[model samples]
Target: MEDPIFSPPLHRQRHQFVIDFIKRNKPQKVLDLGCSECTLLKQLRFHREMELLVGLDIDGATLKKKMHGLAPMSTDYLQPSDDQLRIELYQGSVTQRDARLRGFDLVTSIELIEHLTLADVERFSEVVFGYMAPVAVIVSTPNFEFNILFPGKTGFRHYDHKFEWSRAEFKSWALKVCLDYGYEVEFTGVGEPPPGQQESVGFCSQIGVFHRLGGRAVCNMMFCDDAEDEFSYTLLYSKNYPSLHDNNILQRVLVTEVLSGAEKLRRKWAEETNGERDAADTQAEGDWEERHRASEQHLEMEEKQTDVFLLVEIPSSEVEISVNQMDCKTLQQAEQQRGFWRSIRKLRKKICFGLMAEDNRSLGKCVSVPLAVLWSGCPKVRALGGSLSNLRQLLMDHPGVTLSQDGSAVLLNDQEHEEEYDDLEDSGYAEARQCSHSVEPEEDWDANV
Candidate 1:
């Protein structure tokens, strides 16, 4: 994979250099110039922090063929997510000024300038630095000084290279570009130097990283009227992944996580209760009142069963404290499962969205999750300026979910009821539903596993 003279493949080293730069800077928008085969773009797509990614190249045929690799895979559809990473590809030369290419946070030209003729090289300098005016620019070229290390090589390293600048020549061009374009540059490169020539020569591929001067770092989106001429570049591919900011996508992702988590909690509580009734299963198919009373019976049975854990002679007040303590420990142990949320924390940590979700059959159909679990794993709801009230409203709107009378838990898979759930007339029924809502009331919602 590497050149005969290079130990670490030249292309791989260049890509790693760019990826590492991105990790440190965390740019939101990135544009790659001369993205042949788009291998870097493919790798960059995994970075969710980059909301907008665009790749440009003169090779239209190749760009069109390889860009589809950037599309969301099947698992992305199944297990919804909050991060909205959008990727686009265009067929155009880097020298041409496309309105869309301007204002990128990071612009990269890896081993590209050497392919252009001397005249086009000057145009590239003007277009990328003076016109596109990206906040930062990274340009790497073959180090002409390192060419002496290759035994049979002479003249330019590659057949297509119009010219390969030595370390001094590359620095001269980069410094001039910065001086004219209001940028400051730092020179660095990847790939090791020759065996005994560390100080004598630079890396096999020399790189120039330029940043815009203080106030010049902004992307002037309104740079000129030419920017409105959107046809300057042909868009080869475009895809916007699901984002929490988007209402429909957010609701689906949040509700799915909540419903699944709640179902697990209820099922787990039932199994450990040792023949205690399942509230959701025994819920009467008739009016809400019957379902409320049936749920009460289950709670009474659970309380009585757990009482066996305490001595028969305890006072009533002490007995209440003892039951509460036991219930808290039981729920704490159940929620300590493996990292579904670790990957799902979009605004919190960030979910890497490629794994298939568990099958619906295994999760079962008639699943209901308590509101506490739903509100805890609510999927960056607060990041979107939302509260529990807003989340409940979204779940209220979900087709498969039904909010119980007291707004305590969401019932799932039940047939749609036309009857208004506004407020019930019966006080006893409301209290029963409210009691069921407190299933794990004392557990901290903010602290998740």
Candidate 2:
């Protein structure tokens, strides 16, 4: 097995290039071909929104162990927990094994293709390109000519490898494959081809970026002889990607990569921290007020929203608010929702409301309204919007407040409360509104997952 840990400086350069390339594609479901120990996937996993991450390797036992350790870290793109990003690993050879994988946004074969025979390469490409999700396929192999740079560091080309191609040979083969499969191919360098002849510049390990056309395979066959004959080469596969917003491809790629990476890190950290947390530990940790303030600060930092509209139905209420189309309170409730925190879109300000009244007893059964709406008179007092007899009494003595029941709902129609919220937002006090009380210990952490 090749030691990725000791990867030569050149190989590391190639690996980084591939990582950046994949990040550009923004794949949802990723198939990691010839995944050894899955370190690359683990690192890359945190930088993107992943749906299903499947790792394939010939070593079943190692793959199993890796998967077990990762299972608890897996989560929905919106609610990734440490345990939910568990990668599914399969043991099988690329040539002899069938992944039955289709619709993958990206397929990667890093330093794995060099070990195959001509027949094996054909089979490997067929399966990879056939099932690829029209977005991108990245295949990297040792640049045979550049092996001169490392005297004793030739790849797995002993008796196991049928043949290895120079950069030009690999590019030629790639071109033929792309032509037959209908994929557009681009070449990327791994490690700089040590300063040498002009042609040697492209002589490092060859990375073929295969872009599937409309989800269809393009190339049928690429001959080694043909690759040897071609002269012109292009960097079509240079790292670039489309953005939902207008920006240069490189800028969008960087921004998206950072955003996804940050999210993945938070999820990974949360998973690690959440697993070991205990009631006593949390109780004994930091000052309650300070931690609460920190949590609120964290929340505010994440308050920036995406353009996409999210509809969240309050657990007990029939009302579902479109975070983009809601009142401030609804937006606040949306903010408190778990998914809302993970998404970084600017929410549209339209909120949808629904009223649920099963009977007189269930009038104010909603749990989200109280915390979302502030009572003006008492900064601490929040109206849950129900005419509970107990609440009515609390407000009656607390003049300048009205808990008047309107139909089946009790409106915490306090002018002072509204005024304060207005003032808070207008004067930019909202950002300064530090939580006055300690955030309750997350009693629901272990209970939720």
Candidate 3:
């Protein structure tokens, strides 16, 4: 039976190209670089004519699960297949040349080079050409210049791709590698270009085939003592930070101190304001009752007098005293009303303080105290009225007030106090200073004031 007709899709084209090349050359042994999960290797396995098929990858677990009946072997112990067709899986890095990689008839790395960092590309070139020195090498990569043809494609084909090369750039690098390694090279496209194009601008994918001129291989291929160190593992794109135990402790201490100070200031202000109101109320009530008793005695004297003139005079003074007492009583009631409102305001402030304290506790878990303080404009502390100025001064005089290497405030331990922090400069401090000016006591205090 003849081979099935494969579609001309970009991905299918790549596999077809490699299959055709393999069928024509009929290499005895073949190596596949970055053979993850053996997707392409499984396709290649259909051809039983090849005596040896070696799949190399960094992930041993993946190869074990994917490549059936292919036992894992140490890089040093890898041997070419003696049977009619044998598949071998070697867990290793292509960037590092191993002696086992030598004497291959063909080497194929499909869409692998773009995943490597620029620094690793040089090592990869040396390993494939200067070291393995296969009879033929085939490589494929995405054409970045042709990416515009696809709708809504923003960046590289894959997030893991460190860099993508244009057709011209790929040709330039491929030609240089062939020239340096004494190989004749050819380039081809895997996808059709846009319609109405007279010349070949580029392709969605680019392929290169390199044929060694004399099949002369270099020795040892830059022997690496740590050649066993694999580069085939997944790259972690996100940053990792050490646990924030120390920072958490520092934040807790700072928050505790701030809360304590704020409570004290609130208590002091409340006591002073309440005491004045209480004293005024006591004085007004006492004076009003005394005048009422005096008015009663005057009325009694007026009732005992027989002359109407004396009665009228005494009643007038009594009436005047009664009015004065009424005014004092009204003043006392006003003071009581003010006290009630003051208590209400204080209650609101207490509630706000509790909420702010909870916020501080949560903020401590994620950020250092000084950075949080600066970021939030010290809202909780500022809500302490006149105490805000004192807190600002305290922070300024604090020995631990230093900026981190990243310019955020660093909550230093006591031992780190003597260390110089001249390298730490924060432009944010200026913005923080401006923000602090706008930080007034919370609006709850307006009712009391």
Candidate 4:
């Protein structure tokens, strides 16, 4: 099906122009002002040029809903890359001064200025230019002069438009903005003109590109919000979900291996107990019954099992970390939990091994290392700093045991317990890896069929 976001050729044309402009400029950081429904921002998500994307809007509810709806799909095409593009959404007015909005390379406001009052327009220009101080800014608005071409059009194009400006009005405002903010401005138009009308005077929309004057070309700032209250702004989605067929296969294999191993161990212990009982019966007739009871108790104790719980923190959104508790009874159970972590690892490129501790004052204490030190998995990772030295040491001690090239399965080596796991290696264990990564969609894209 055609993407509903790209319908209506006017908006699509505007979005394409902005996207093309960004591609040419190759901005590392991009800010989308008044990102309603995130239609343009969604298209920009696929672009590899942007390292960080920030979308701000005054309608907090709409922004939240749109972000949630546009959450990444479970496709390999959307898999996280080495550079790891980060997308963030914020609920706030563009006319206001926000420290979070500062330090962007390019800021885009598409069909947004017409909704604002003239006073808000001046404030928006000041905040974007004087405070945020991006190297480049692109703004687009409806050209009232072109409205005459529409046969029945009367007043404003839309009910929400505070005002629309003619080409001359837009150019005059843009030039004054450039003069005030020490920026060089360029003018452009979108849409076809009437047969008799000049292209400049009859286009449907007007665009202005503002280039900042001499200063530092780049600046770095923390784009992720860490405050507990800021979690509402983050967008999260899970990918690489396991299918029912795959889950059924995995269940059958694990059950067969576990039951078989348990039965073998039980029989071996029973045989050893029988030999001892026979010897006791011959040596002492009175103690035979006592020894038999002790053997039965030992077997019963071996049958009982305890569950293990592990607290793991997974990267969820740009600004939030998802903490999950993994519950398992046996080694196989623990291994089953690897699928979730593997997906996260693939998206992030390198998985950071961290020490998770329970704390009374806070939610939990997590000491995580940087990605560079994490991938190397060396003892020198401790020197990088933070209270994560213990985690680095643990990783250094076990090399290539937990994390693998495919990041699907973890191998445990225990010489004493080799016999117990002999069946596991042969019982279709590698099949679990297949379920961890992207799988072909069950449905075909051919709508006609």
* lDDT of each residue in 194-237, candidate 2, tens digit only: 45653754645677888876542322222212422321111111
Point to the candidate with the largest lDDT: 1
Q: For model 2, what is the C-alpha lDDT against the true structure? A: 0.49
Residue-pair clashes per prediction, in order, are 3, 39, 0, 0
- Residue-pair clash count for candidate 4: 0
Error of 4 at 64 (Å): 1.7
Task: State TM-scores per candidate.
Answer: 0.67, 0.45, 0.44, 0.50
| Candidate 4 segments exceeding 4 Å error | 1-8, 76-79, 218-449
* Runs with alpha carbons beyond 4 Å of true place in candidate 1: 4-7, 79-81, 215-231, 272-373, 376-386, 405-408, 412-449
**Model 1 residue 116 lDDT?**
98
lDDT of 4: 0.58
Candidate structures ordered by TM-score, highest first = 1, 4, 2, 3
**In the order shown, what is each candidate's alpha-carbon RMSD?**
17.4, 24.8, 23.7, 23.7
Q: lDDT tens digits, residues 1-449, model 4?
A: 11232235678888999889988988888999889898988898777687778888888778767776545556523223334466778777777776756778999999999999999999988888877879889999988987776767799988999999998899999999889877888888677665668654666778998888763343333234453321223332222222212433333333333233334444565467557655543444334335435634553455443322222222431212211221223333534564533332322211111111123113322122233333244332223213354333433344332323433222222222233223333444344333322243242211101
Task: Identify the superior model by TM-score, candidate 1 or candidate 3.
Answer: 1
Task: Give residue 101's error in model 4 in angstroms.
Answer: 1.0
Q: Runs in model 2 with CA error above 4 Å?
A: 1-11, 73-86, 96-100, 131-134, 152-160, 196-198, 201-203, 215-449
Q: What lDDT score goes with residue 71 in model 1? A: 85
What do the candidate models score in CA lDDT, each in turn? Answer: 0.67, 0.49, 0.58, 0.58
